[model samples]
Target chain A: MLRVLIFSIFASSAAFAAESGGMPQLDPNSWVPQIFWLIITFGGLYIVISKIVFPRLSESIEQRNDYVSDLVDEAKTLAEQTEKLNNEYKELISNSKKEAQEIITNGRKKLNAEFDKKKNELDKNISELTEKAEKEIQSFKSNSIKDVQTIASQVSGELLKELSLNDEIDQNIIIKKIEDISKKKMGELN
Target chain B: MANPMNQFEVKTIGPKIEIGNFDISFSNASLFMVITVATISLLFIFATKKKSLVPSRLQLLAEMAYEFVAKMISETAGSKARPYFPFILTLFLFVLFCNMIGMIPYSFTVTSHIIVTFALAIFIFIGVTIIGFVKHGFGYLKLFVPSGVPVVLLPIIVVIEVISYLSRPVSLSVRLFANMMAGHTMMKVFGGFVISLGLVGGWLPLGFSVALTGLEILVAFLQAYVFAILTCIYLNDALNLHH
Candidate 1:
């Protein structure tokens, strides 16, 4: 099929050349320069485009896309880190608050215990002082009673010697002496 | 009286240069090819100088041309070959503009010539071949042999594949040259009829000329599209090496 087609083209060219009065029209040589020139031109153009122009364009596009993606990833990472740090800070704050509360509660308990201990010691000291005062009062009363008895006995002996001379005066003297003795004992006890 | 075929004549300028056995002449055809290149370059430069989001008229046209070629390449060759969109777009625009510009009052259609179209086709052929080799190296040769072919028919299939590969350029070139030449020749012949018939009877051929002119315009665009699309297909084969 292809041979037939090629043959017809060459044949047509031949016929055209023949009809044109052997003027060397549509000659193969006429087309040779054009063919060679075309090959050279296209070859040079393709090389320049493939090697230089296309590579530059493609690289620029790829670089732009990569830069954009990198920026997005960086933003995402920063956001995640920020969230993590915020959570950590919140946890620290909550823990500190709980610790502070616990310390305050423990301090109040210690103060209350110390206050109760001081109150118990003051009560015991007051009781011991009152008991000592009672003992001293009892000793003073006993000494006064002995002194009063001796004095009374001396006075009675002198009075009895006088009464022997006056027997009738003894009854009135005894009664007066008894009354004075009772009064002395009551004053000493008070 | 104007001749219809007169437009196609190769007019020599100054003196012909002879190099050894070859006698090469620079004619109106070559001159117009250079003009075509310059015109296309200027058109693109001027149109695309301020490529706006909301395009101006010229920018709109330029963008439309770009979009047309881009879509064609993507649709025909797939997304992997989308990188070649610029080259293919430039080829399409240059060819399209040249063909359309030739339809002007007194202009030469460079694409009508086999040498010009063949140059383009052969360039694509060489480029595709180089790509296949560069990508797959010696393995590129495997493209010629089918995998599922029976042992008995292997020789025949291989021969067919080789022939097909070799004929790619010829088919690619001939398809463009033939279409442009045939359509322009028909337009010229019809134009001759309109001129030969004087004012009273001329209206009939004049009307035919108008319709033929519109048809020629469509053919011009169609030829460019066909040439570019085929180039994409060839490039696909080079890239994928599909059977």
Candidate 2:
């Protein structure tokens, strides 16, 4: 390969530098060239690495870290949002249940109040009618009793007139006797 | 037969250039260093061209190098070394390539030279000391004073600390230079033995050479890692003044 040939050319030329006085590394003469090349090569490498290579590598790493952190932040925000929505839904369900219980209780109370009011009104009317019926019955019984007493007295007097022995009887006594007879007949009929 | 040690000898690759009496001619070490830099540059350029998040093979390698250096810096120096990441990463890659390329048969190890290693270590030392002074002003001198040392031992401890601090460049450069040079020398010695032993007995020393090569490869990587990590630690000490 062309690359290998070029390498060999440089290699052969450099190897030829090994044939002089002592260990070339320790020789005073060789230090100059080594130092010269060192300055050029090392200095150039330093400039290149510091100015260009390192920064790019560091930037790439930073960019990757930033991308990962951004994803984490987004995921955390979405999780928080979901939690908020879930809490709201829970509150809604609980509120609806509370409202339903209140409605049932109100309906039951209203229905019971209406039923009690109608029953009380019917009770008052029934009591009044019963009292009136009792009073009317009492008045009718008193009138009938008085009339029976009077009629009994009159019949008794006519019978006594027809009979000669009744002339000796007192008026008061006759009335009392008629009343007693009517009382006896009332007791037997009751 | 050519002496095995002759491989370590220095020679000029081309026409000599002179600058004010300085003999800075083109040489093997320079060539290898140039090769290392070029390869490193091409690798990064190719690896990063696509910029794909899902990495290709080269991209993965590039990314690994980036992360490896970054992690090492953060671990040893903390995040304050963020700005110095490129410098440290460059040093690691360069030294790593230098060590690895030297493992090739008949190739020069640029890092094997004492002068080169010392130059790098001295650069690191001077830079770190400057940073320490800039950050802490005169307070940087307090690095030698241990916080909890008994008063009796304070003088001795401070002396020790100061010596160690001053010896940073020497220790750093010598450690890397010695490791690489010793490994390569040992391999060469065993290679010589294999040749001298001929086919019948070469197998035993050859096996040793193989094992030593593998070990040397591992050492090459480790030494570079250690070198960079120590640099980071020194940088940390300066940046934070955590002596």
Question: In candidate 1, what are the lDDT values of residues A36-143, reduced to their tens digit?
Answer: 433443454445434543343334435555878999999999999999999999999999999999999999999888888888898888888888888888887787
- For residues B1-243, could you state the per-residue lDDT of candidate 1 as single tens digits? 343345655565568766675545566665665566566555656665554445578756765676676678778778878778767866776678778888887887767767778788877899889988998899999999888899999999999999999999899888877766666665666577777887878889788779878988998999888989999998887788777
Error of model 2, residue B218, in angstroms: 1.6
Off by over 4 Å in 2: A1-23, A81-190
Best by TM-score: 2
RMSD of each: 12.3, 10.3
What residue pairs clash in candidate 2, if any at all? A23-B8, A24-B10
Error of 1 at B220 (Å): 0.6
CA shift of A173, model 2, Å: 66
Please report how far candidate 1 places residue A49 from its true position, in Å: 12
Sum up the clashes in candidate 1. Answer: 0
User: Chain A vs. true chain A, TM-score per candidate?
Assistant: 0.49, 0.45
